[model samples]
Target chain A: MIVAKRKPFDEIMEMLEEYKKVLVVGCGTCVAVCLVGGEKEANILATELEMARKLADNPIEVDSVTLERQCDREYLAELDDKQTDYDALISMACGVGIQFLAERFPDKPVFPAVDTAGLAVNQAVGWYEERCRSCQQCVLAWTGGICPVTMCAKGLYNGPCGGTNLGNCEIDPDQPCAWYLIHERLAKQGRLHHIKQIYEAVGWRDTMPRTLIQPGYKKPEKEEAK
Target chain B: MSTDNGLKSGSNLEKILKAGHFAFTGELGPPRGTGAKEVIEKAQHLKGNVDSVNITDNQTAVVRMASWAASLLLVQEGLEPNFQMVCRDRNRLAMQADILGVYTHGVKNMLCLSGDHAKFGDHPDAKGVFDIDSMQLIAMVKQMRDEGKFLGGAEIEHPPKIFIGAASNPFAVPHEWRVHRLAKKIEAGVDFIQTQCIYNMERFRQFIKEANDMGLTEKCFILAGVTPMKSVGMAKYMKNKVPGMDVPDEIIERLQGAGKGKVAEEGIKIACEQIEEFKEMKGVAGVHLMAIEWEHKVPEIAERAGVLPRPTVE
Candidate 1:
């Protein structure tokens, strides 16, 4: 799932420096799952913003709404009041949600309140570890389930670099060397021979920012003269 | 143009190795900060005493003057440098560019190493980019030389003709697998390998014996590494702390028994003894003396070990 973290209090305040009244919109999908932007968080943030403004003697009103998803227009339609009473909107969703909301309400200033980190899996409560780089081309089958593109510090496709010490990366001891894990995994499956072949350098053309258009999915042009 | 000795246009070390001479290579670590004064001085101490000097690429992952720049400085000092390039800092883009850059500056011999992790060095916060493993790097350079092409097969106007080198660790765990790994690197087009420091002769002997059984000795030069222990503390640190390094208990005990100020001398003696025995070991080519920061000891140790007065290839 996509993982994101809330911006620090000071940075959020800086984004709201020029505004007095604000509407905080939260996403109920990824941001909610990652425990950053949800109905509860949106309410808490509203209270915190009120207190921050009160402490500064610059009193301001804040209201919030949790949309089913900030990315979907249907969910965004829930906030179609067209009431431009607020000075700005603080989106507590991923960058996609923030941009989509901005496009829907073109007149109001929309700002992101969180940084979209990466695709990750939850290791435990309050901890989300990055698992994939979304390189668009997956080599998991060949590597025995270990993702060197994201796990290895150098993103090497071949075997471990010489600096792999004690099965831990030389750069960070906490992280296991990706190739080491791959070797162990491959060895376990009796597919160790696959580790020997020299792999070709990865091409980033299709993966740089991957997008897809399925067959027969494109909108067809109007039929001209038969 | 080739030198008068009719060796390659690049490294004198390459010429020496090609001529079937026992090569004695030492390592020179570039200073952490700018200013080449310290590196140049160290090179001067090793000049003429060893065939070629390897300028480390941020040895132990601590940042230093760029290895290429240090290599160029050594070249200016009239010393052939076996430049060591690590994959930890740059991706394939910068790596390929630096290979060409080093070749243009007259570097002839190059070693590909997976650099030590950044956490072991001063900059623990920095991220590491292991874009390509050492094995792939060897193949990449070999391709650049043999086919005059990049990793993606784009032709270069002038290809870098470098003698490729890689590192080997016989002491690391899963010892039986190391020889095969060396074979893989050899298959990838490596010409020579410098093993991790040898304090465990028994393990190293087994490694070489297995390597010979696989007939890997004929394919590449095996330069056994020997770093003399400066103190028992260093020995303990290497044995317990350093990864892929093995300092046998006997050696550590021997260092502890060295008594007072004699540990350093005892360490040198042990290193000299290993060099002496390694010269007679079958399939062993020569000794790679890595006196690390103690660069001054290289000449004296080389002299005592009888690999002194490096061969003149021309």
Candidate 2:
């Protein structure tokens, strides 16, 4: 899942203070699964915000709405009728959802209510940790199920860092060194012998810049020439 | 020396919730088997930490001690229990009677839910009685409070006053369904809402804004629920084993980033940080802490977050 954490409430309130009537939009897909943009959370937040606004004596008018998926144009269209009622749009979706709302509602200001973290999976009931970087590449096959890029503190591709001691990473003595874990796993599979293979020392892409596509996909157009 | 003390005042929890910027709550899963002692012990430990204890009725499809029984125990022990009554376990008749039973015992808080499927619990063969969903239950309670009559049309001798509440899991699929449920619950006369544990504060902030825009925020008190994971492995289990919960990846990364024994400390620290963040933000009333098995860590978390005891409510 595209994991994103909700921004702190005070920051949100500060951003929202400019408007009298604020519309909070929640996205159901990615943010929903992560409990970021889901409907229930949206309502809870709306209730708290309204209460805070009232308590503050500002008495702002707030509206809560959740779209099936904020990334889609069709879902964004659903808000077309109600879009004008609010002075601002506070989106609960990931970065993509916020921008989509912004693009769809050019007249209104779209603010991101959540900060998009990297991709993650639920580790357990109340636990979720990062497992992937969405690096636009797949390398899990070569390194067992563990991803060295995300798990390793140093992000070293080859093997254990020199600091690894007693199966724990030197950076945080209490934490299992990611390399130690990788080494342990490889050893268990009798693949520790593979660790000695001379790896081609290749550099990863030098610069990693974040990018977002507006309305992400497009169909191929017809050829101009006959 | 302060460890393993007997029951404290219910105000401990109240104070904690009010002290924080936002509040959180979660169900106290009954013991794995039928034993009042285990459940009672958990409640006692959780008592002063959480705003209110939600004694769950057959959580995760598992059959265990009855919620009413457990809630009654909590109240008798001077603790506030948010009795989670699911329609899946009882018919309306039993439910009505149980509601009366609990209220008389001074257990006023409740979270209406449709119990999990029998197959989902420990006993798959168990029969499920979803006589009502959360909305219907809320509606029934509201009618009892407002009209002074039960679903059976019998006049209540003296209508009970309860802090009516309901549950909402925004992480459930068909995301719009979560909103629809909230609207329905509010319409049914819910006074407050205690949501599924949330990890993503940004989403929660947006959630608040949306609810405000929809005018739903005006209707009730919203308490954000939080559960501090004991370990990274435990976090993984919550993600894999527990249904209806959503833990964001950033939190996991941070936890996974923490080394072994440090993860627990880090989890508590994260919770404290979230609590602090919630307190500073607008549109939040209180936080309900659900420390789960780490109930003892609650006081430390609260204290660290600067949510110390108030001078005592009059």
Candidate 3:
């Protein structure tokens, strides 16, 4: 899931200070599962903003709403009527959701309330760890299901560098060395031959603002003229 | 075995090792600034005492003068530099360009390494660019040197003729796999391997034996790495803080038992003993003396280790 964390309270306050009235928006999907930008968080933020503004002798009115998923246009249609009276919109969703909100309400200023971390799995109620970089190429089958691209600090393609000590990374003792884990897993499965093969340099497709057209979504070819 | 007549790169280090002489190499870290004074001064200490000097590439990830440029400085001083390149700061294009650039400047030997992570460096926020690991870098250089072609399969007008070297760590975890890793590096076309510092002789002996059993010793030159412990504190720091460093407690206790002012002498004595052992150990071709920041002590250590009067090979 896409994990995100709320931006610092001071930065969010500064962004909304110029507007007298604002609407706080939240998403109900990934951010909600991560416990950052759900309906409950939006309500808490709205109440805090009102109290903080009142104490500063700049009383302002704030309203908040939680949509099913801000990335989909159908769910975003719910904000058409409620967004007209606000001076600006504050999005507590991930970066993608915030951008979608801005694109829909082009006239109103949209400010992000949370910083999108990365693609991760929820470890516990409040903890999460990154699992994949979505580098557009996956090599899990050869590496015993361990993603070296995300797990290794250096993202090494071959075996471990010279810094693996006692199965831990040189950067941090608590972080287990990814190659060490891969080696043990492969050795246990009797697939040690997989790591022995030399892997070529990774062909990174990290061009910014990448767009992926799923197989069925790609445009159909033009019909041949008879 | 390769001989001087069939030298691959004609580097002084390669020639010495090829001539069946016990090779001696030292390491020199470039200064943090752009000045050449430190490089030149350090080069003077290793001039005739060692076969070749390794110019480190931002050792420990700290920013410094570029390794290739520092190596050129050594070349200008009539010294051969085993220029070190790391995959931490540049992509493949930059790496290949630097290899070609350094070769034109008279640098002959090259060492490929996956550098220390930038998080441990002076600029912790710097982005690390590990476009290729050390293994692939070795194969790429070999292809460029032996086949006269670039990694993209484009023919080069004049490809770099480099005697490639790579680092090995026998003390890293999954201990039994270390020898197999050496075999993979050998298969990748590395001509020589310099291991991590050795304080645990028993473990190192086992590693060398395994390498020999697997015929890795006959394929490539294995140089044992040794660093003199300056004091008891340094030993403790290496054992506790440094990764892939296996400093046995006995060595630390030995340094402490040296009494107040004799610890430095004791450290050098211990290094000399290890070098002496490496001289007799089978499959060991040389000793890479890394007196970090203590380059002046290299000549003295080399002298006592009986690797001097350095060999002169054609």
Instruction: Please report the candidate that would top DockQ against the real structure.
Output: 3
Cα lDDT of model 1 by residue, A120-139, tens digit: 89898879999898778898
> Which regions of candidate 3 are displaced past 4 Å?
A219-226, B1-5
Return the clash pairs for model 1, or none: A154-B129, A154-B130, A154-B131, A170-B117, A171-B117, A171-B118, B5-B314
Candidate order by DockQ, decreasing, is 3, 1, 2
Index of the highest-lDDT prediction = 3
lDDT of 3 at B95: 98
CA RMSD, predictions in order: 3.6, 27.3, 3.0
lDDT of 2 by residue, A147-225 (tens): 8667765454543422344556544557666655665677579775454342322234423765555596554465621
- TM-score of chain B in each prediction: 0.96, 0.86, 0.98
TM per prediction = 0.91, 0.53, 0.96
Model 3 chain B lDDT-worst window of ten: B1-10
Weakest 10 consecutive residues, lDDT, candidate 2 chain B?
Answer: B1-10
CA lDDT of every candidate = 0.85, 0.70, 0.92
Worst 10 residues of 3 chain A by lDDT: A217-226
What DockQ values do the models have?
0.41, 0.01, 0.79
**Candidate 1 lDDT score at position B256:** 90
What are the per-model numbers of colliding residue pairs? 7, 48, 0
